[model samples]
Target chain A: MTAENVTAADPDTTVRAPVPSERRGPSSSAPRMLWGLVVLVAVSALALTTDGFVSVANARAILSSVSFTGILAVGTVVIMLSGNLFSLSIGTSAAVSSMLFLYLLPDVGFVLAVLLTLVAGYATFALQGAIVGRLDGNAIIVTIGAGALQVGAVTWLLPGSVQVPDGVDIGFLTRSVLGLPFPLYVFLAVALLVQCWLHYSATGRQVELVGENKAAARAAGLPTGKLVTVAFAVAGLCTAITGILLAGFNQNANLAVSGTFTFDAIAAAIVGGSSVIGGRGSAARAVLGAVIIATIANMLLLRGFGTGVRVLVEGIVVVLVVVAAQRRKRSIA
Target chain B: MTTRPGMARLARRSRRGGLPYVLLVVMLLVFVVLPVVAGQQVTSFNYYNLFQVFASLGLLSVALGLTMIAGEFDLSVLGTYAFAGLVAVKLGADDPVVGLLAALVLAALIGALQGALVAWFRLPSAAVSLGVYIALLGLTATISDSKTVPYNNLNVSDVLDRQYLEIFSLRSIIAILAVAAIAVTMTYTRFGRDVRAIGSDRRASLRIGVRVDSILVVLFVLSALLSALGGSMLALSLAAATPDPGFDPLIFALTAVLLGGVSLRGGTGTVLGIAAGILTLSLLRELLTVLATPTYVSSLATGGLLLVVAFAAAPGLNAWWLSMRRPTKRVAEPPSLSRVG
Candidate 1:
């Protein structure tokens, strides 16, 4: 899970080598710095102007809301670094794992069900990674197919919502600490570890190398297939974690709201300065993206917009951010 | 990498005559022969039901196939379907023809807007169109008030409802005509050649003086317009519209495009092939439903087909595997090695 950054300093592993521009683009602090300031200004303005924006309860709500998307974004960033673009299947992965977690909870109890779900998540995503990387399949179609398969399976097999067992103590996963839910800590911990690995580890650098140029990476003797597989596996693990925690947060396993999570995660990653072209950004930035989306979504709610409006607003924001990111990339090139 | 599959298919097609017939035979086995044998569904198959289902998705797959021919993904076609359907159903309460024209024009304009972003502004078609899609979905829901409109009040268009021999509807005929128009355009027109040429190699097309960006815009607009037609036909057939039709139709459309052997990487295949794909899926769904299986199972099958179609279409796995077998095959890097060494 952790990469060895020290080993990444081999003469051939130099970051300053003739890597793709996206690999070097992150080294310049301009786009990231601009994003941070924009987020800061937006937050300050909202806090100053809105009535309930600064409340601890709203802050807590925002934190809880962002945990799933934030964690998902971290995984998406890794896949992007590998240059596969995205997995449209992340939402389905969450829904499948969460539904499976609930389904198995009554039968296998808690720990075992959670464990089984984690494995399922890994296998599901790993299959996609294998097909896309090993067989050189298109990422978009593979992911879209995988997503449809997962959702259809759940719909056909599970059919409806399942409740948590009465005696299973699911309270621990969502219990509050310092005005924030436990899930927030989980998100932060995952982001911290991923940030460290991506910025300071050998495998992390290899992931970048593969993403920056699959051909170049292969020419340089890197194991491109295995690295890509690992990236998807990481995404699956994160999605599975989110799934289990969501069951705890909602006190039930549900499939009614399976639409927005995957797109939101991709939006967060793009907003956080991660290039869809791969080999850029960090988990820390993805965390920033999640927070930004959360704040905007929360703000829309506070302003009396319906759920539909909120979704529309999120799409507008993503479009704007992607356009800006594209402009920046073009300028840098 | 994205273009590899389509390019490979074109390459293979050039080297072999009658390959398309072989593919058509394979498609028949999957779409017709297998379903008939597995469930005896052929006798139970209703022509009206089949063509009704075919009317919407068939157009959608053809529309999507055209864009893929032009070397881009149009995830927004589904979005256009919903949006244009929303407009037509809402406005048709007064006049159906006006509603149809409005939907078509708006759909085309919306498509052109997205195409401008991809062509003029140089945005990634997938991501940008995805944003457009999500937004359109949300807008459709919002404008429709998040409820299924009964649509009982609207006067049905006489043209859309006109029946031929009590089996073939005018709407289905229109859909077939649209497909024919697109096929003729792709096969016989300079625009068609340029679109395929652009998909095969954009830079080369540009170097040969094709108006690459404008042609891309036209292809996108055509896709959008057809998607709207599909939606309008759906509204007419169902006599209702839902805020969300979900994505089952989109998946089926994509599956049809792939199954009919249209390449996702673009610049290959035919309207006839895409129609065959649509027929396969539409009939498959009808068979599954008639067999007392849940409708969701069709979606599951759709997912499976997506993977299979994408895999089959690539046409490059053997060559790629051969290359993989040869390690240390370091093709030399061009100069500017070591950053301008």
Candidate 2:
């Protein structure tokens, strides 16, 4: 549903708080901005110490690499904020979406293929949402099952990687715009849009309300189920966007297109201080989280550290952030 | 005497509602009988193959089921499996027992650490276990250097795989014994009751003095040990280990646990049911192989079965179905009166 429908339906409820004060107050933003600054300073110092880390080429590389996962992390924030925990099937969904896009690209034009792929992704995740929200199924388990089903169906139907047709030139999708990769722009745009939606839209605020306290929201006669479905549908759209960009960048798609995206996005979301307990977090924060992770990995790469080390650090960061967040919440309570 | 009636009634109802047993029988009939009816010879070898596939994954299902029964999750099982396999292959070049012990010990340590974090902080088990999962995966990759590690001794594989009584192998026998032991512990011990209670309601269990934290730690340790044992045996049997064992086993284990009627909300399910669930899966795999279907079909079947089972077990759907069957009763009782006197 659009913002207008929500406004029209709840005209009398406008006197109530539009957004949760804790989320947008200066007290919260000040600490968060300071943390961001600290990370930036640390990264800058590391860049200065490392050879070629400060180059424009390296900056572009980092942004380009973070774009797909950044978009995915933003999507994950939506589901996490909806109190569904995390979707283990995000990587699989992205893979399936990309494969569908490629499969359709040969038959249809690029635009139509992308549109169809987006619809398929949204439908798949929306069904999962309905199961979780309406059927009261466990979100984590349902998503896990959905992911496995997606992978199984994809592998069964398309035995191998799907590639762009020989005559089709979709290079423009991956091309750099104003010295930045196209995906980076898309990532920024998505982050900005979702951030605005969460802050400005009535439906988005209801989603946060449901996440914050499902029982309370239900008692208040909110459409909690529909809000959850909307959150998941929005997540699906973000993943579809990621998949489309990924396929464009690679010129091919397969089951392994973004196998690690699920964990990576989750790590980014957690590290960005998104409350895993739900009702807290922002798309912009998730974007910043993605950038922080990518920058750290880039630094590790420049330092000759292995993928194992990078992954280990990422895991450690997630644990630390989760623990820290738990402590903070406990103290607040 | 009042409590006796309620307890007896509960027991009787559980026995009557044997979903797992019924599902297992249906699955066996479909997978086994259909093949034979199609003119295929159902040999002891097929049973052996079925058990062989069941050996490792069955243990994983049990491991995951234990944690689920205790109201937690252990995504680290997959990572531990791969890591243990790699460790066993890399360390047990001379003595298999030594490598298995080392792997199990390390897994126990990892499990204990995770349990401590979850219990001490009252953290979400899924999130904590996920972090552990990623870290263990990193460890596995580091140890194996992203390559397959092969055991130098082929004799160990031969011995583990050698058929006994025309149907059972040493590994399969061990797996069954372990499952039986755990089932006995869970069904007959006070510890089992505590775990179930915790799953059903953590606060209530704590109020009743269940030692929730210590039990949680123990359960996690047991889960990790089972997974490591399974991984070690599989590696010894196959004579090789890899950095990545793929997520197929994780999905299979999860599907088996759910099929066993373990509610994701926790507090229900039997170990016997879990065993049946694993067997059902094993039989399905064997049937697909016999039918000469593509490997992807197995994935599709398992995944689809998982979704179907989950959907079927949904509380909302069950309530809706109940209401549909007894619409008059639903209309007669107000919702508030149903909960309060």
Candidate 3:
């Protein structure tokens, strides 16, 4: 029996429960130890696999990759916590943002273009959230439809062919600042801030409660609908930020690439141990998951795996991580 | 139990089944009237074009519906479709029949294994199947070198293309067969009820002694086999197997199924509803094409349609308004399923 259950049980009615509870505490610690072992082993494997996996260069690469995805994952984590299975528009949001940023770079500086894209992404996601949160609709379908519309809009709005302008290419943005790439530093800072907010803030606690049991949360007086909408809007902001970084990395914005990020972000978040059924995720895991995926992908590319094989491996890893997480959750419960 | 007047009104509406029927009628009319409103010839062409698109796409939708009914999502439809198509093309050398059978069986095996993993291990279907999709997509590319194989032999296409006796329509016949088979399984088979029961309530089904895991595994296998069959047929019809036929079909099939009023929650949809969904979406696409909408515009329309239908079908807005307008204490909790999915 759990410690909570033992305390909840009547003293006279559950005399034997104390015996189990005494044993359960030591056993419960084992799971915590196991979590530590998993992290230790994963870090070790990453260190051993690549020559400089622990080096500044590798760390920067990992951070850059994780930041964009981590930002998106944070948003998705909120939605997932709210009990939604998937958010469909993130990919299109990213694509639209990237395309818009690229198209506008000539007219505006890269930074302003990025800001504009972020606002657009936030607005679009807010719209999606409102529709999902307010109007009774399938989250998957609504976002997917919205995504498609956005992709189409981007395609029409931008000139033919899917490449970024030369002005916005990686030359200026790729340089390291303060011993770490700007993107990586940005991602870490965001992760720390979000983690603090989600852990300590009243709104964070309310969001968690909403995720855990919407009925109960509502009963306790919470703005469940608006909360869900905000979560989606946050996800949009993450997607837009990711798109900007991605545009910098590629030195070109491509809609095709943007579409893949949709599932990639989901996979990364899930692999890092985010729950699909919702109400469980952390910025740390979100970033960790993105790192793991990006590492694996980078390795596959280095190993010269065909596109098909690389995708397959990446997919398998995602499934395995999710399955493992689910099994763990079930066993613990 | 005492209830307010508004609550009583809502209860009464639930008892009346008019809403569903009205929605169906409206959708049908949209498909029929909207195209004609644009232009007459275009609408008529859409009727014929609609059949081809439906035959190709409906196969995957039905397959997805089966899995959806079992309360799981498989994102591997794209890969499986591609895998099956590639298999057919590679084996088309000796005999078209051999090639066809090979593709179907390979796909079935892959499906069964995936289904087994998902059900037996209780793995998330989306996650597991996505892995399968990626692996199969890789396998297809590695095996076929990412290029399409064209079988120029007219004999093979001729044999696979037409309905029996040249009088019947091939695509139409397949559509009928698929619908019939699914209908029979759903309406008559014990297995079908088992699936529905599990979908309706997994815990309750388990308590009632249903073999929830085994039944789901079988359902996944069956769904995969059907998807593979669809891919193979498409390959035979087109006389070429490319690496990407599967990719396009998956999303479109999903849109069709959801639009058909099959609850994504599972266990509440019908083959007829699915058919209507497919026909409606496909016809709309054809209508758009006939209207000379650009390719990008066409896709945008598809997405827009999905959003409209999603909102209209479920209406989260009402739920939000109810939650916000009513005092927090007086408002009952939103339905748990409604909030999550």
Candidate 4:
């Protein structure tokens, strides 16, 4: 969402505000200029050194890989902005959703099954959101508890093994239509829609206000609790969609892979510069962040580091990104 | 805005004494009493075992609660725990002292890196830790070859296998020691004060001249250290280190802490409460097992409990509803202000 920048008319006023010095530069062509140069340098380096790093086919693959994470990150961005921390159960919820899809596909057609999953996700997330925001419950604790419950549910419901039936396919959701995969298109469309919702809608604006200052927002007569609940519900819908797509992506839904997706989604959001404090973020940035992390993941696999090495590398990278973001925030403050 | 101040104050005062005590009694009855009333063997071992399970889980919960109380989340604790276990098992096989040191050092380093980023750089600990968790998970998988690292050493296995090692036994000497240490550190130490101050109000804390940044970093490192220790011990007891064990600790430990009255917003509750919380949950689990409940029922039961506890533990949940019917309310309520003002 684009924040309406309120610039001071006088330089004296700008200097007097408690704005962190690092965020201040000559308001003229300085910060943007510096950032532009950094981007240019990075692009040039990629162009000169890497093989197929910028190729269309590789880009398509990266896009496809990032779609689910992008959706997840976008959903999280909404919740995070609304001032809650990690949706501890998201991974588990997604896992359960994916598993449910495969388990139910035989009983219900693929379309109905997916539609039902979206509803389930929305309800689950919304209830949690209500408990957290309306009741002032702790987000992290509630989610963790919910996650444990979900894990148990999944394990118990499909004990030992469960699989998607063979020969049943969702070609429409998975097949490539243009240079990009269908999932990639879905991701972009969803991103665009979220961006529109966040930027243009009254409720979206209210969501930002709640995130910015929940007490103040509530005092101001905004339905801070309702917005938070909706934000989580939206997160649920997005994550469930990602789960369904993932099942189709792998052609099977497995519970074991849920952990990776959960962590990665958070990683992508943080990398993209989403604020953990809530109220400051964008769908575009969130998706881009997901792509960067996913790309790194893809590179690790390509390099044959195996799962362990990949995990280590990913952790290290997150540490680096976190450090950088933190430094920037501190300097700004 | 129209309510009388005297009346409001009277109602609030009465609520402070009445509400939480009532809720606590109700919770104890539902989870603790009903099961015990059903049967003696059913209740005692179940509750005892539950206490044991929670005592182990409480160690990690305290660690997590410490960081969270400081307004940060550290998912890296899972990695730290797993890595600690892996290192301990790998090295302890050769020498227990070496294994212990390696695990502590690794966990500390992970904590330091994450803490520095969060405290000094001002990064959101949640995102950073997510990355850290993924990496650590990967590392654990790689180092353990995606398989369980069994405690093959006879001496180590024997130490772990002793019945005394279980919670409620002398073997839980380590668990008791840990709880005591945490109690002292949290209540008596300067760092603990700073953590509480910061968690309660970061801006005010900073203005008051607390080194909020460094304190957070140190606490995170400390939390990780504690978690790693717990994890290593757990692995030893189980005679194996598995990639999946850390997840339960992550969730259950945190849940117990919250249920025990540790507010997720931080600056509330005590180590004692957290320990009690863990014991309560562990006991409940054990009781369920003893009841011969169907396999699928436990999850639904756990979920229901979590929801109930979540509501129960919510800030002001008890009084918020009751205060509605009271005759008085605060008159000088702060007027709704501009969102950005």
Candidate 5:
């Protein structure tokens, strides 16, 4: 029997049948548009009612605050799209990358430091990808182990905090571009590039196919392992961008700086309506998710709600999205 | 008739599941015996400390192992641990038992909710539990006001920590008894068999009338209770609770579960293996402490061990190794001949 027929014959495999393309047509886009409209109205209402919410400074604050998380979320989208699930090591990888950037800034100059830091991030995640793809290790557990190893090794080798030496120039990274922070621009650029790549590229489609049904993809002779590894490599590059920008913006780096990056990135991706099970998300959607979270957090800060409430709401939103998506999938099937 | 075959399968599976125990023995020899042989004074106090750590983290490991064996991942255990610790400390200041009861009750509710969502919707437990995890952390922060809560009765800690028989304490004894009870239940009960059957194939179990949803709910509730009990005990012993207990407990629990020979794919593992894994880790920690090595070394060792174990456990590793060993096998045998054979 053909692989497709075999997969269809298996009841267990049939449960997770690849969502039809027709379902992603008008049916999906309509609800997505409505959600966008609702968000716009809500943001407008918040601006009209709340004091200081409409100002450019507040806007800059919100964008810049979410820039690093947004970048990391975009990376998370790639991993999810390729069916690797979330990388729990984003925070540690970012922290390690930031430390590397700072440590290299004085010796190698800004451009070289950034390039080398990106390479390190890519290499680190590529190794994890190799294990997950080539060796069939559990993605979540592999990332967790990698996170611990990074934290332990960094703590043993580097000082508690790293700072660029005197006379080193990294102001270009922190400088504004068209009235927005440099990191914000990077977030936008990365989102646009990745979104286009996922939509238009052959490899990206193969990634989505692999994520939809890995066994089927393997049967079809697709390079599932290589595609998964490429997804992870792209994610690593995005994380490295966040790390470099964070170091440049803060003018120093520390182990604790990326404390909530992993969770926050995950929250962004899921809230963006991305399936945690994989193959149905984009960088643009992740950016929107990040923006929504940041705006809500900003509003909460203005209204005197603590960080706890903001985080509580974020968690609620993720759970709602996940449940809603599952219900929708069930109905569609 | 059905259970007979299942039991025999389990028996055969467990006979091969002796790696964790062997690892435990090796760790004991390296960490406990070697230290004493090197003229390091091994006192009852050391054993006391070792069991104290074991009782707390060991419970968490067992909780995680149970859920994993039932084909679900409960990431909220860490959040539950921290929240329960804070709840026990803040509310149980006057009466420790009340605090523990309240914590367990709350944990049960949380577990039930998460279990229902996952079971009813057929959602991924990892994602669902992660949401609960975040919410629990937020709840913990709100209750503790993002600060450490101190118990009014410091004597409670002293009582819990009071050593007996050179090693066992009140807390350790409770933990050990709980583990023993669970081990027995898992080995000699219909519930245990159903859990394994479900993990092996959820749809098949459902078709076979396994009551998959309810069993999953009970497993989650049990896991949450164990974690809460562990957290409450730790809080009482420490005489304080923090909003964040950090990721160390989760990491340690996961490492222990994996090292215990529990497959991430689920449906295969023993509670005794989990206990041995926990003991091995505890001894390693004690060894590091005795050596006065830097704290990060333990983290490095634990992380490295997790990676090594994960890599070793990968399904493709065996296939890759076989292919590597006989690189010319495919060339030597043509496709048609191989298929005919």
Candidate 6:
């Protein structure tokens, strides 16, 4: 939680307002600690109170199912940490790519389909990144517009759902590896890779630095614009990857295949201890956050709550998390 | 209060037939000229089709513009839109008076809650509203049980279907009146100036004694009320309420606001511009409907239009009022050289 604490205030590092907040180290850790406790209590309560929640089957279900959002959360957290705020179009791009993957699979085969979908996703985000990163436009609203554009365009071209041909095999995607689902492995691998990149690689550190203080990064001779664009590009790719993974799993990509998971991914990022203000957090933290959300959802399903009740719970949780996160940000600032 | 020059420039600017009026001209061409050129008869008979679009969507554009002018977002307002329609149609099944009050009250409370949180926390309004939107979606589902409640019990028309000049409905009248009132409030009142001030610079506004939070709170509440009212009115007009109208209107309204020439950064926009923008979109939609294009195509067109308008409108904001063809004094001459996009 206090990743910033370990980041020593090299004269270059503390280029922005070098406030006392910079020195206020261990306090931010309180939230992470509290989060740990919350997760612990909630897990025990669910295990103790709910039926069959502690079983391995249920554990596998929860873990494998939420990896879709888990992967998405990693990308969103990285984007937020890099100081781009959030992308409203995450779901849109994912849905478009999912549709694209489904459509292209029969005509071009699987590998090419996946590659083309990733390229399409990368192109979409690259444009948004260029516009926002270079022009200093409002990221949130811009994405909203782009999302609408994408949905509209896609709907215009293809208004109906398509199914993957029965002959197309997703056995490899569905198959387990070392007792875990393949999807879970991919999710974890991506998260770990991102964590390593953020903590170890020079480029990753520069991305974080650029996010923390764009002006400082510019002064320190960082390729701030390119890094920010790369951040968005990565985000776009993650969502597209998740989309194709989902198509592979579900064998269907309905025109209305929802990217509603975008909001959930963001909520997970917040709960996982990522700051919306940017330049702080890890992919593992986001994965943890995704797990927390999945646990709540699993418990609700276990309790036989209706979709309405589950949705309401998710909404309230997001609001509360945002409130607490904003409060923490203000206190530190 | 140092408002003299800004107001004076605004007054001079409004008389100059600016961008809003230019958009109005475009709207008229779309509504009248092109259709005629295409050999389509858009008589008073089908004018209601256009009016209905304006009545429902234009009101939303006006409502969104009000908040945008104050520098805030209210994403949950559309959720209230669907929710309000449900409340009014369901509660007013027998007597609309009960439904109207219930829906309005519910909208007020929802807006109040959102407004308070947004003001107190200083959180990004987008994220906060996302929460509200999702929660409200759940609430609407729970209440309606995910069913599209048919509103056949009442002669909805007796209560709200009154028409003017054989074209305008009572709902349009109410909407226009609401918009007119907002126009006056934003233009002549000190509160409007404060909103502009805060948008221009929050800290400076605070130093100048602007009640930034309160202004924002009111704007949010007002936005909710408008959204709810718009939703209810549409429901009343249609004589039914869907469980999920979703955020379609929110996006359309936003596009219209930008089309109306409201800056995304807030302030420096006029209600007249937004009104014209709303009309332009309504006519565009009407034309597409006439052409029998699919929903997605129109949506795509609208979204593309919004992006183009947003980018192109900002630099020429002050200059557009004169005429689309007339260049402003400050508009550089041919960029003094060739330029890449």
lDDT of 6 by residue, A1-333 (tens): 122322432333453545224523578668757866876696677756899888989999998878888988998998887887788778767778888898888899988999999998888887777666655555665677788888887776764686887688866776778888898988998899889988899988998887777766755667666787888888888888888988877778864566457777887887787777675778988998899888887888898887676667777877877787666444321
Candidate 3 wrong stretches, greater than 4 Å: A1-75, A108-111, A161-170, A328-333, B1-46, B144-154, B163-168, B245-248, B315-341
Query: lDDT of each prediction vs. the true structure?
Result: 0.77, 0.83, 0.69, 0.72, 0.84, 0.76
The local lDDT score (0 to 100) that residue A48 gets in candidate 3 is 66
TM-score of each: 0.88, 0.90, 0.83, 0.83, 0.92, 0.87
Task: Please give, as one word, the docking class of candidate 6.
Answer: acceptable
**Could you give candidate 3's per-residue lDDT for residues B1-341 as a string of tens digits?**
55788898888655432333445567567766766787755434356556666666787888888788777877777677778877877886777778878987888788888877777667767667866776676677778777887766567766555545433347557766877788798878898898888776776788789998788778877787777777877787788888755334766887777766666667667676777778767766765666678888877777776776676656444555566787552224433343444
Question: Clashing residue pairs, candidate 2?
Answer: none
The collision pairs in model 5 are none
Best by lDDT: 5
Pairs that clash in candidate 1 = A3-A201, A4-A202, A5-A201, A81-A279
Task: Give per-residue CA lDDT, model 5, range B1-341, as digits (tens).
Answer: 99999999899676659988988889877875777777777677877887887778889999999999987888988888888998898889789989999999999999888888888887888888888888888787778788888887988898898888988999999989998999999889999999988887887898889998899999899899899889989998998898877678988898888889888888888899999889888888888888777878988988887888889878778766766798744211212333434
Error of 3 at B97 (Å): 2.6
What is the clash count for each candidate, in the order shown? 4, 0, 13, 7, 0, 5
lDDT of 6 by residue, B1-341 (tens): 57999898788767543776687677777777777777776766466666666667777677777777777766787788888989999998888778877888898898888878877887777778878887888788878888888888656755566667887777777887888887898889998788888766676787778888788888888888887888887887788888777556876888788778777777667787788788777777777766667788877887677666655544333333333466443221222222222
Position A54, candidate 3: lDDT:
55
Candidate 1 iRMSD in angstroms: 7.5
Model 2: residue B265 alpha-carbon error in angstroms? 1.4
Higher-TM-score candidate among 2 and 5? 5
DockQ of 5: 0.47
Docking class of 4: acceptable
Candidate 1, residues B185-275, lDDT tens digits: the string is 8889998889988887776787889997799888889999999999977885577776677666677787788777666667777777777
Candidate 6 regions exceeding 4 Å error are A1-25, A39-47, A218-221, A328-333, B1-17, B157-159, B313-341
Best by DockQ: 5
Error of 2 at B152 (Å): 1.8
Better of 3 and 5 by DockQ: 5
**What is residue A312's positional error in candidate 4, in angstroms?**
3.1
Instruction: Give the top-scoring candidate (TM-score).
Output: 5
Report interface Cα RMSD per prediction.
7.5, 7.3, 7.2, 7.1, 4.7, 9.6
